[model samples]
Target: MSLEKLDLASPDLVNENIEKIAALFPNCVTESSKGKAIDFDLLKQELSDSVVEGNKERYRLEWPGKREAIVTANLPTTKTLRPVREDSVDFDNTENLYIEGDNLEVLKLLQESYLNKIKMIYIDPPYNTGKDFIYKDNFSKDEEKELLESGQTDEYKNRLITNPDTAGRYHSDWLSMMYSRLKLARNLLTQDGAVFVSIDENENHNLRKICDEIFGERNFVAELIWQKKTGSSDAKNIATITEYVIIYSKEITSLAFNQDEDAHDNARYKYKDEYYEERGPFYYDNLDRGTLGYHESLDYGIPTPNGGLAFPNGRTKKLNDGWRWKWGKKKLEWGLNNGFIEVQESSSKDCGWGVYYKIYLNVDNEGNPKKRSSPYKNIIQGILNTHASNEAKDLFNRTGIFSNPKPTNLIYNLLKIGSNENDILLDFFSGSASSAQAVLKANSEDNFRRKYIQVQIPEPTDDKSDAFKEGYNSICEIGKERIRRAAKKIKEETKADIDYGFRVYRLDESNMQDVYYKPQEYDQGQLDAFADNVKPDRTSDDLLAQVMIDWGLPLSLKIERIDIKGKEVFKVAENSLYACFDKGIDEEFAKEIANDSPLRIVFKDSGFKNDTAKTNVKQLLKQLSPETEMKVI
Candidate 1:
């Protein structure tokens, strides 16, 4: 059978689960009056005692809008991402992305293509400080119509609403906003992926509880305390100097952090000998142990290098009734044979001699010293808030283009620990585009190809603010400019061959017309109105973009245009995908494209010359490359 047009709507997860359960237990699945649904009674019977039933007491984080938040996440949106080539740098080649929209809608639009793809997500969301602007998602309202009516949008039509402490649903509104976005973001993470969220004391506890519920408590990595400043003068009681970075992994066992070695770690390995030079320097640890109880196995003594008998001293008493060597007999013997144990003369009056275990510098199996490094600790100090503000000033060339932008170094360190070369890093709350700058800087330093996807709502700048006066009307303007300036600065400074560019995409209504959504509502007379299925305002590039998303292809893929006969063909990622939205596409054009043997292809349904041509196109492709998947939109 030939392929049909992809359903552009977001996946109905509830129905998907129902079908999955129906597959496992057919008896439990039945058609309800509303439609197909799982019979919970039957399912419980099938599961027997294994399933927990009823409204029993359970450990869960609950709030006023928790249920609505879940519904908002599951509800599909007809929104699409439109490419803005004008706001982009190296649009055709760059793997980086900067998406301007409500993060909740943007995350949902990204769910398909980026599912299980992102290696790391770092977000500095609003900390709910009573004055912070929180996203208000009105699922009931039409996004496009709402923006048009408000008249507050710039060219991109991005909008936001503030959440003030005076509102009755202050905490509930903030929680609701974060809950849906976080839920969708979890799906985009790779199995080894990790998410880092920055927040202050304002909602740290609440954020942690919700994160526990969403990411599972077992995947919780660490709660890092970042010293934002030496101290804050605005504190009422305790002088709060630190904020937190809550880290969680998609899968705890699959995740690992890159260790960085500081001067202090290198100093730990002190002694080096010619024999152990290949293994690097090492330090000695006393082999004596003080025991609270008797242990028969570790009570033995050993012969010293000076022909002296050294008795085990437990440190509590002289070599008499105390415990002995820390290592057991077998390990002690192995260490002695391997030259890992050393005997030295005792300087202390309590013991005759001291036994030492040589702890060598961490090394690989090849006897080469491992990368000098230490595991990332929970406490992150030395980074100051002033450093972040100064970074903003330097980038914008204005005193206050953006306030309190995160230091690029801070994000760079986080990226170094959580990701590697060629991995994708996303920041849905990419205020000031700090993570984007950090990604570029990191890539330049390490000669990597890591990509980033940054999303920020175009929150309006206050008229009296310096940023507004400096020609930035919204937060997104500052973010885009920051990336542009940062990319240029990095290229000039490092001269490294890195992708110092990003494509810009803005969230908007789907390119498909209303007829495509509600085909059953129209009659044959009205069918003429939908001769061109795509919206009139949309370009061929816009339709191609939606096709890319519909097919779960990366938006960063290289696109090239070529003429086959008189019609233009769009080739994406070489031969990974081909789309021709032009009308009157005939059998000859289809054959010309099939000759390229693309993995997948799409075309406008009405673009075909006729039904015969359409059938011929399918047959020709099947004959040429039977494995090729073809779809018509």
Candidate 2:
């Protein structure tokens, strides 16, 4: 087989699914002359009445740019994440990632490798307050050239603008920006994964509608109310002290809420009995039911300890009606036989005796002792914005570096419920990297090896702000510093053997030169001028990054450089992949690599000594390791 270049872009999911279906049922799949277009008519006919088509009145949420939002989500990006080893901590070993770029583009770049891989995502996107910065995705134009010409970008090349309420399409612009990002983010979630988004009253309703459309209304988990603050001094009418966190699951049926052990400890299971030593604490619940609208079968009187029947009555005993036990006859008999029902003399004259059901704290359905815990509640309380602000101030040693930073505890609790040990957590809108700190702290506390990927745009800090004055030109700088500080603090405090470092990557143009993309337009003279397909400034590491992206390999995998026959060869994730991009590669070097029999190997097309040497290497690899998939860049 001849070696071919791998397309370095996100896969077209629709076409991939079509190919799978064709493989399973060849008769149901038909192709057209226009590059294998699916014959929908035959496919539908094969399925008979199992599918619905051409429904004009279907339910869907829409807005001005809804269609464009979908197009943006499907569009492939030519951007790649370039490693910044100088800015990274433990670059060779850490599984954590700190990606500085426009999150929309970053999410698209991550689609291939991270598809259905992330366990939980927690994003604190801009609440769309009038003064907050909003992203404007100009998909119609070249992003890099447009930003360079618009003068809206900082030295780091992050394109952003303040979105005021007076903007003509205030709501529409914000909605469009969120829609595309959310759509792409959903693809990275595992089947049992979930996402939590933080918002306020300004766009809570719109965000809910957008999530309903993207994640499917059936997957809507809960709308959590967080008591962000105790008071709002600048209120016009009502003092708004709460914000919302909308939760959605990839598949609701597969998601389960983790139990809160601390909450279970404070439960009111105070009663003790003869079996308390074995059954643990117990609580008494009322067994009597109201007579009004009561069923006759449930109205039978319950026997009292005083040899009398208990009946339902008003406080003054003005109306005496037949009483009903909360449990049916068989259940009551079971409870009585198991000593779970108790009758005691009542203090009130209205009822001579009280019937009660015993609920044991550590008991199973069969009334045997078992450990139990409580499910976390939707309403999260006691976490205030002031706490988050204090944390930011303490971390930065200054005030106003970042505003309204989320508390690490809040994100820590969310991570606890949404993720398990070793699962991947993502936060695309990672302002100030609070989620990163939370992940680090959680891993240390629980002795877990969980991984995190944080994406944040290097939005320029205000010139007069404290952060800018402190040498932090962009929010990304402040976020990266926070992670370093948090990692050091967590290590010193916990002394845990957990990963407290992250790998740093920045988004940029693909490593391939422009000529590589438009090879057909170049004449022989032009092609000869561009001998190397890769860009001039890109290093061997940059080319390897693109290779990983094209091959759908995790970017955090361990990479090592080894000398083979006095030529440097890069090995990634052990034997998973090997590459040699050095010049003057000979048959001896190629044969040495072939003897290793790696799963995959790549070489620079121009690095070989001659065509005869390349042919010799290929033949040797085919004979020695026929199973190895080899490619040339």
Q: Model 1 compared with the native: what TM-score?
A: 0.80
In candidate 2, what are the lDDT values of residues 26-120, reduced to their tens digit? 77666667445567666766766665465346566667877787777777777788999999999988999999999998998888789899999
| Worst lDDT 10-window in candidate 1 | 259-268
lDDT of 1 by residue, 221-269 (tens): 9888888887778879989888888999999999877666233234456
* Superposition error at 436 for model 2 (Å): 0.3
Q: By summed lDDT, which 10 consecutive residues of candidate 2 come out lowest?
A: 311-320
Candidate 2 regions with alpha-carbon error over 4 angstroms: 13-55, 142-148, 152-157, 262-373, 377-379
lDDT of each: 0.81, 0.81
Clashing pairs in 1: 261-373
